[model samples]
Target chain A: MSTAVAHRPGLHSWLTLIRCEAKMVVRDTAGLVVPIGLPLLILVMNASAAGDEEITAGRTALDLYILPLVFTIVTATIGIINMPSFLAYYRRSGILRRLAVTPASPAMVLIAQVVVSLIQAILGIALAFAVAVLAFGAHLPVDLGPAVGIVALSIAAMYALGMVVAALAPTPNSAVAIGLVGFFGLGALGGLFGGRDSLPGPLATLGEWLPFGASVEALSNAWAGQPVEAVHLLSLAVSAVLGAGIAAMFFRWD
Target chain B: MSEPAILAEGLHKQYGDTVAVDDISLRVERGETLGILGMNGAGKTTTVELIAGLRAPDRGSVRVLGLDPRRDRGAVRQVLGVQLQHAYLHGALTVVELLELYRSFYPDPRSTEELLELVELTGQRKTRFEKLSGGQQQRLSIALALAGRPQAVILDELTTGLDPRARRRMWAAVESLREETVILVSHAMEEVERLCDRVALIDAGRILASGTPAELVAQSGAPNLDEAFVALTGKELEIEEESA
Candidate 1:
């Protein structure tokens, strides 16, 4: 009956939220398979398909294209699909309602979900990297630190975009369906699948500014140990902010 | 104690053209348990939702412990607990896991084990929310409501569809709690008669009578709460007329 000044033990509180979300994510294996297995399959195909014929950009290799698709896959999986589904699930289950009445901040809930999705993206990258190395003879990235940065940026943007999609969708299923379309559509447009050279100049230019494309460019630059362009970072930052804002406006707990 | 734990004035809610909760006002004081009796579509749920801050009333205001439920939701929420009928938790999560998770929300949550023991679900702590029987789920729900140790608890038709023994168990469980205030929305007049200190008999979204059990029975010249309710509302003879 009394509202005491609610306090938690610092990072442990945030970390506990993250850990709980991660446990739920891992326990729901059906959700995990989509993000992980698909990326591995694509990595193998690209490594096998690597050739002059597969190179659309004059100096680009097939695996280079896979970098952006990695993010596209991650974005679709977490940002678009998982965001709405989980939000709806929480709202319906009264988990959000209970949490709404609690001392825990909504920002923390946002962070926990993003962390869970980021962990999944990490697993995807690890899986792809393993496939590239063992199955397709991919030489690993020279720069570990930069690669890590790229992964982090790519995941952050994807997570944010996912939040936007989840907020906009009418229902959880609708969010997932629409999210997948945009998820894969942008990836394909960003020259993930192939045939970028045949596209109109305006369309190709527009594609470069799209979410995963910009992220892929930054990540690939990072993997090559080259300094990342500030534009890429800015684009990602914008997507994230916009996404978080949308989630704040529309995210319902009860 | 001068101010009631709950108070509402001119509460009106509309979903487009449908007036769900039509201009209702009621109040409950500290240590008072108010039972609301209404049939389906009588605006019971809407009224409860309005008071609970689950929905924003289109007109008028609601205050729980002197704080507006809508405007001061977080502050008021910390002070009030609600257990809605047929409300459920995550199916995959065990009762213990659920209790632990819910505990994280409250600044000073009750001991999970003690709550389970109090609800008589101590042995079923490992059971998932879906795994428990209907009665067990109801008990766990009461346990969850008690989690925050709130000043007021609102139970929306807590005993509907429950068997006799289960209903009795729930009543006993509720009685043992030393709640400052409890508002029960139920159709069962006997359930209200058994547990409530006071009740508001509502029909068509308006309070028909408000008093102690014996007072209502005596005022209506009825043998019991049911007959009293039927007499006060004047709906029983209408049913009889329809049946005839």
Candidate 2:
């Protein structure tokens, strides 16, 4: 009984929010591709071939890269698409104005949304990991603890980035445009499609500072059971703090 | 005689050089329906927005339910309900779903079935907001405002696009909320005269006159509220025409 009370508007509300977010993204066929189906397909394909192709001279394998990359993509997808969708629909429909008069604070709504994105990111990573292990000869990260930390920070950073996009785009089209550009541009450079080595010197160094880059570097390090370097830890911490601060300062529901 | 549910004292709102709500002061007592009548830029919506805590006043204070609307906004929100001047609903959800969504915000939300039935939308409960007629959508907007089972309801242009029959139905619904205070804003004098217990006519961001319909008619020596409105706002109307 005590446990249930501890969760007032707790697990149930969060679960309901997840279902709601899923329904909106799945409302159209095009929306479905971006969230679930596409990520899973990449996970399966990457994991099998990852073991064969030598990622580094040491044969680190592509399967190891898949988990962190999938995590970043899922976080971006949840924020990029859903954040703008939330604002656009509400602003257009005057739901924000209605909510402005309700006891439900806009901050609470945004927090719920961030929670939803985190849940989706975790689910997508789990699925990708499953496919990598089952389909390909992939091993679980040698240090699972730090990998989980990377996931948490990655969600925070991307959710903040998503808010920046949501705040700037007054229309849904603009939001989608901005989110897509940032997603692919940052995702690719941060090692989603390829490793950081392919980039030029300055760009590779710059990638290390990005939210996506921090997660990528941290996760890759953890899979090897190496301690997370100060640079990587600082990068992740900076991304988390800066992203959350800006999101809180700039977020607009209408 | 009782304390007003909504009160504004020397309220002012300005956007740089232009004044949106120009030192407006008004009050609506408990259970009294107040009509906010005005020309296009007369600041009716601004006043309502300030009173609803969507905007803060640059000068003076607004108290609703004995709490400052700006300082105690969340508490005010708990007790007050609002229907926007423009009816916009999230298109992704059905009527029933939208009601349920708002229902979650309150500790004691009204039943979804009861709210839909009140708006005569039970038949279309499964339909998305866009799928409904303009009048039906407006009705649903009003339904959402009442979801919290509030002490006060603000309906801005409640029946703007409604056909005569639908408008009549809306007025009936408004009139039926016996225990709730309502503030209705509209351009139609007939809506004011027919529905509101007391009316405040605004011209150029200020109230021209405020009194019960019978009292205003007796004061103006006009046969109906329409002639009285025309007489009170005739000068403001001329200014608008010349500017245009």
Candidate 3:
């Protein structure tokens, strides 16, 4: 019998793995719809009133507040809730353990899942932007570069938080439960229900430093053509680093 | 090519205070079929898992085709195919899709059609893993283990949920792999009698005896391996719980 050795998987193999990951995301109706749908719904309800009022520069309240909130929702929903649940499912079901025995490392699955989740986030952001622009006549951020930068930072921060959820959660259901609690807790403080101004002084101060609040505050500045606060950017960057560190320390393959 | 297909010596594994495998040694030469017979939780699974490099041995070494399984993981994985007890695959993936994914992980892998036919899963190629029956899932698991066309294979509880006809078909598949090394973990005496060139009886994480199925029966003064197994491993019933 031939004893030819198997080589590490190449780019084509990665594409195939990614394609399968995408299929799983698409097939889960609830996972597919909620992240985009819930945010779009919020945007539609708030866009009409917010779009009429200008906050600063050529941007309206819709651009400075509503749009940033909607975009953050897109990233947080996919990163915190959807992604972690899938990972926890794989771990609980032993898919990661099984892959560890094969030539393909389990890290391949994590990367593929991240790729798929990123695409989903992009799709959600695009849909919300389209509806806000065409239906409500909303305009793009005046400081487009900074706005883009903040959105990217927001995505990284939320996914880092999701990794923590995936690492600690023992089961798929528990992952979702934990993710939801995290989302709502952060959302409640970060102006998901209303502006942080309505919150108590110390809580409002804390909200501005958290990922969701910091993300919104930075993007709002970018929309108004103002310099993004150094503290907010620092907050997001720190959250990303700490979240990844915690996950790496606690995560198990099996 | 002349090296033993698998060699394990003084294997010891523990979980907290419980010993899963205790000072066990096993060797299988090239093209040999060794059946590891044990009652549930008798370290049969743990033994094969150690050999497969899925779990680390606290006080032993495992070599596959003369290469350390842990140290030479990449090379060892290329030549060793393992079918573990649990069917741990993505539930959303279809049979063909899962096969394709595994196929990508190897330089030379069996074709989807060939593997499906081998495991009698051709008709369910498009069916998702969660939708398959228990027996079908077991067959697919076996098919996956063979996907890489490995030189050595480890099969744990190969036909646990299979029907008689399916069991015979699986046995035939194993029979056809005569030139390859195989380590089969089983509780079925008939399976061991029919397929293994040699056998090892294990109890309490240690090997009680090992030889040809007929030799084991002869040594125990029992008519068949079933009665011989009881005679060799002690007839008293012991309820043992798995530590892992």
Once model 1 is optimally superposed onto the true structure by TM-score, how far is the C-alpha of residue A250 displaced, in angstroms?
3.8
Task: Pick out the ten consecutive residues of candidate 1 chain A with the lowest summed lDDT.
Answer: A51-60
Candidate 3 TM-score over all chains jointly: 0.95
DockQ of 1: 0.31
The TM-score obtained by model 2 is 0.88
DockQ of every predicted complex: 0.31, 0.32, 0.55
User: Candidate 1, which segments miss by more than 4 Å at Cα?
Assistant: A1-16, A48-63, A105-107, A134-137, A140-147, A198-202, A225-235, B236-244
Question: Which ten-residue region of model 3 chain B has the weakest summed lDDT?
Answer: B235-244
List clashing residue pairs in candidate 1: A79-A162, A80-A162
lDDT tens readout by residue for model 2, B1-244: 6677888899899988989888899898888899998777788888898888889889878888787767876667768899987757666668887887777766678999889889899899989887899889889988989998888999988887678899888988898899898999887777888898999888777888889988887777878777777766774332112111
Residue by residue across B35-133, what tens digits does model 1's lDDT show?
Answer: 887666678878988998878888888888887777776677677888876566656667887777666666777899889878888888888777889
lDDT per residue (tens digit) for residues A87-192 in model 2: 6665666666666677766665566656665665677677766776676666767788887877777676677777777777768678878888888777766886
Q: Model 2: share of native contacts present? A: 0.38
Off by over 4 Å in 2: A1-22, A25-29, A44-48, A53-60, A168-173, B217-223, B235-244
In lDDT terms, how accurate is model 2?
0.75
By descending lDDT, how would the candidates be arranged? 3, 2, 1
lDDT of 1 at A170: 77
TM-score of chain A for the candidates in order shown: 0.81, 0.82, 0.96
Error of 3 at A12 (Å): 1.3
Give the per-residue lDDT digits (tens) of candidate 1, residues A1-254. 33423344246557767767776777788887778877666666666766233332232454455654664565556666676677767655666665544446555776787777777777777777666657665554446576666667667677777777767777767776877787777777666676455668887666667766677777666555567788777777787788778877986555
Worst 10 residues of 2 chain B by lDDT: B235-244
